[model samples]
Target: MNKQGTFVAVATSILAMAAAGSASAAESGKFQIKAFATKVAVDGAITKVKVDQLRLPAGADTRAKDAWVPTVAAEYFFSPRVSVETICCVTQHDVRGSGPLNGAALVDNAEVIPATVTVKYHFPLSSGVKPYVGAGPAYFMVFGEKVGASARALGATKVGLSSELGAALQAGVDIPLPGKAVGLSIDVKRYFVDTTAQFRAGDRVVLETKHKLDPWVASAGVAWRF
Candidate 1:
C-alpha cells in the first residue's frame, strides 16, 4: 500500500483499540495511551545564499512555501503527573526564488519526516480535567527531493537539503468523558528547526542558503488509560 493508505490503516487500528479498552481505562491505571490527529503549519525564514563567501545582493529573495499535513502521537505515563510521548508526521514543501532569480522554481514536493520525543508534566487540577506542558527534541529526515522543471531547464543539476535537529514545546489540556474511560485532548506545539538548502549543477553549486522552519502543530483527539 502507499504511504497514505498505511497512515489511514494505522489510525483506524488505534481508534479501534482505544474504543475497546475504554471500558477499563477511565479509572487511571499505570499506563495511559492517547491517540491524536493533528494539523501542522509551517512558518519559515530563508537566509540569502553566499557565493564564494560573498552574500547575494538585496534582491535575491529566496523563500520556502508553507505546508500543511496530518500527524499522530502516543503517550506513555509512568506516573500520575509525568509521562513520555512521541509524535511523527510527513510533509512536502515548494521552493521558490525572486529578486535576482525571479521566476526560479527550485524544488517541488520535497518530503520531510519529523520524529519527536518529549517528557511531559501533568498538573493535578481535578479528577476529570488535567493541564500539561512538555518539551523535547525533534529529528527531521528529508528525502524525495526533485529539482523543479524550471530549475532543471536552467541547467541546474539537483536539489539537496540537509536533515536537521530541533526542539519542541507543547501545552494542552485533557477533559475526561463524564462516566466513560475515554477522554479528549487538545494541544499545540512549536518546533524550532533549521536546515541548509543546496542547488547544484554538475560539479558547481548554484545557490546555497539556510532556512529556519518553525512550525506550529495543533492537535485534538481521544485517549484511553489502562
Candidate 2:
C-alpha cells in the first residue's frame, strides 16, 4: 500500500529469480551438442598374395600405406560430467604397383564405413576451458579392389569384407565463447580395425591378402549448451 512496500516487493522478486537460476545451474549443469570434421592418415600392416588357390606369396614391402580421409562426428552430453558420441566416415587408399601374370590384374583402391558408440568423461577444471578424453569400440565394413591390366597379374587381385572388435581413442578441449550457451572445441581421434580380401577365379582362391587399417582423425567445431 506504500512506496516503500512496492520497492521491497520488486527487490524480493528479483532475488527470487536469481535464486532459481542458480539452483538450475547447480542441478544437472547443462548438456552440450558438438559436431566436427577431421583428417586422418590411414595405414595398413601387410599385403599377402596367393596363386591358384594354393601357393602363397609375400611382398618385400611391409609398411602400411597412408591415405588422407575426411570424417565427421557428433556427440550429446547427458550431464556436465558424461556424454555419448557416434562417428561415421569413409577412407581411401591408392593402388600399389605389383607383378603381372594372367590377363586378370588386381586393381588397387578401397573404401570403408566405420561407426562407433562411445562414452565420455569430463574432469572438473577451471571455469574458462574444459578438456576430456574417451575410449570405445566400433564396427567397420569395407569394399576393396586390386587391379592390373592383365588378369594373369600375380597379386593384382583384390576382395572386400567386414571386420569387428574395433577400438578408438580421442581427446578434445572446450573453450567458452561470448554467450554462456555456446563454445568452440578442437578434437582428435584414432581408430584401429582389420579387413580381408581375396582374388578368386571360378571359385578358386588365387591371391588373398590381409590389411591392417589404422585411421587418425581430427576436427574442430562449435558446441551449444542447453
Candidate 3:
C-alpha cells in the first residue's frame, strides 16, 4: 500500500523469477534432440571369404574405405546425470578385394544403416562443459550390395549381405554456446559389428565373406535442451 512496500514487493518478485530461471537452467527437462555431421571410419579388415562353404584364403585381407555419414540422435533424460539416447546413420563403403584378387575386381560397394541405443552418464563441470560416456547395442542393416565388373565377368550373378547385431561405446562433451539453450557437441563412438556376405551365381552360392566392420564414428554438431 505504501511506496516502500510496493518497491519491496517488486524486488522480491524479480528475485524469485530470476532464481526460478537459474534453477531451470541448472536442470534440463525430460528430452533433448541432437543432430550432427559425422565421419565414420571402418577400422576392421574383412575376416575372410568363402566359396560355397569353402574358405578363400586371399579374401581374408579385404578392406573397406571410410565413409562420411550424417547422423541424428534423440535422448531422454531419466535423471540429472543419466540419459538414454537413440542414434541413426547411413553410410556407404567401397569394398576392395585383397591378396591374389587384389583390386575392386570382386566387390564394388555396399550401404550400411545402423540404429544404436545407449545409456549415458553425464558429468557436468563448472566450466559449462558436460562430458558423458555411453555403452549400448546397435543393429545394422546392409543393402545395395554389388559385384564388380571383373567378378560379373567371371560369372557372378548376385550379392547379398546379412544383417547383424553389435555393441557400441561412446564418449562425448557438450559445451554451452553463448545462448545457454544451445550447445556444441563432439562425440566419438565405436561399433563392434560382424556380418556375413554371400555371393551367388545363378541359384548356387559362390563366394561368402565375413566382415568385421568395427567402425569408429566421430561427430561434431549442436544440441538443444528444453
Give the Cα lDDT of each candidate: 0.72, 0.58, 0.76
The C-alpha TM-scores of every prediction are 0.76, 0.67, 0.81
Model 2, span 1-226: residue lDDT tens: 5433543454355345434544544335345667665566665544444333534333322233455545445667555656667876676554343332212233445566677766665554777787877666668766654443443444334344446557676678888886567788888777766665555655667655576666777777777766
lDDT of 3 by residue, 33-135 (tens): 8899999888536676555443455434666788887788899876666677898778888777667657745656688888888777777898878898777
Instruction: Give a tens-digit lDDT track for model 1, residues 105-180.
Output: 7788878888888767676576869898777778988888888877787677787888998877778988888989
Leading candidate by TM-score: 3
Query: Where is model 3 more than 4 Å wrong at Cα?
Result: 1-29, 52-60
Q: Output the worst ten-in-a-row residue range by lDDT, candidate 2.
A: 97-106
Q: Between 1 and 2, whose lDDT is larger?
A: 1
- Which numbered prediction scores highest in lDDT against the true structure? 3
Measured by TM-score, how close is model 3 to the native structure? 0.81
Cα-based lDDT at residue 17, candidate 3: 45
> For each candidate, C-alpha RMSD in Å?
10.5, 16.0, 14.9
Q: State the lDDT at 128 in candidate 3.
A: 76
